[model samples]
Target: MPEQTPERTGQPVPEPTSNQVPRLVVTWLVVTVPLAYGLFQTIKSVVPLFTG
Candidate 1:
């Protein structure tokens, strides 16, 4: 076996700073909101067909 570096072994992961958290949260919310809305609309549309 060869010696391992941080990149090779994927150890010692870099931690995100406080500023990064909000950006990530905002990004996730922006993407997920649209996806969730689309899913909700699809389910609503399908449910009417099944019920009728």
Candidate 2:
């Protein structure tokens, strides 16, 4: 068991369950998919400008 500090109460931190794992994956994909697409499009546009 973990110890509690003065600022925090004696309550132990709750561990994530099995269902939360997929939620984390979905959350990351939601954030990362658009980020990856934007990066790809930006690089593609920049490459043409540099070459031409």
Candidate 3:
């Protein structure tokens, strides 16, 4: 396990660094893109049920 710093022990978590931005973006896209595609497919399939 990692050692804790005295300052960090009692403090709130620090803000994400600039280096983390790409990782954050990629993570969000990885989750959201598949979610969006699933929603689109569901809607597309359900529309025919209603229309017919």
Candidate 4:
């Protein structure tokens, strides 16, 4: 069987280090960019009838 380390000792896993921030930022941008674009398009479609 493979050895289990401190993870198997029941301790909580440590938080990611500073080096991981860029990766997380990139992931967030990838998800949010398309989401924001879709929301903007939806609002644009809905707003014209109210204004006109």
lDDT agreement of model 4 with the native: 0.90
- Cα RMSD for predicted model 4: 5.9
lDDT of 2: 0.87
Local accuracy of candidate 3 as per-residue lDDT tens digits, 1-52:
7679656588776666997999999999999999999999999999988899
What is the clash count for each candidate, in the order shown?
A: 0, 0, 0, 0
Tell how far residue 35 is off in model 4, in angstroms. 0.3
Tens-digit lDDT track for model 4 on 1-52? 7677659877787777986899999999999999999999999999989998
Mind giving the per-residue lDDT tens digits that candidate 1 earns over 1-52?
8778677898895765977989999999999999999999999989978899
Clashing pairs in 1: none
Once fitted onto the true fold, the runs of candidate 2 whose alpha carbons sit more than 4 angstroms away are: 1-16
In candidate 3, what residue range of length 10 has the lowest lDDT sum?
A: 5-14
Off-target runs (Cα >4 Å) in candidate 1 are 1-16
Candidate 2 lDDT, tens digit per residue, 1-52? 7556543895676765988999999999999999999999999989978899
| Residue pairs with clashing backbones, model 2 | none
lDDT, candidates in the order shown: 0.90, 0.87, 0.89, 0.90
| Poorest stretch of ten by lDDT in candidate 2 | 2-11
Better of 2 and 3 by lDDT: 3
Pairs of residues at least 3 apart in sequence or in different chains that clash in candidate 3? none
CA RMSD for every model?
7.6, 6.3, 6.7, 5.9
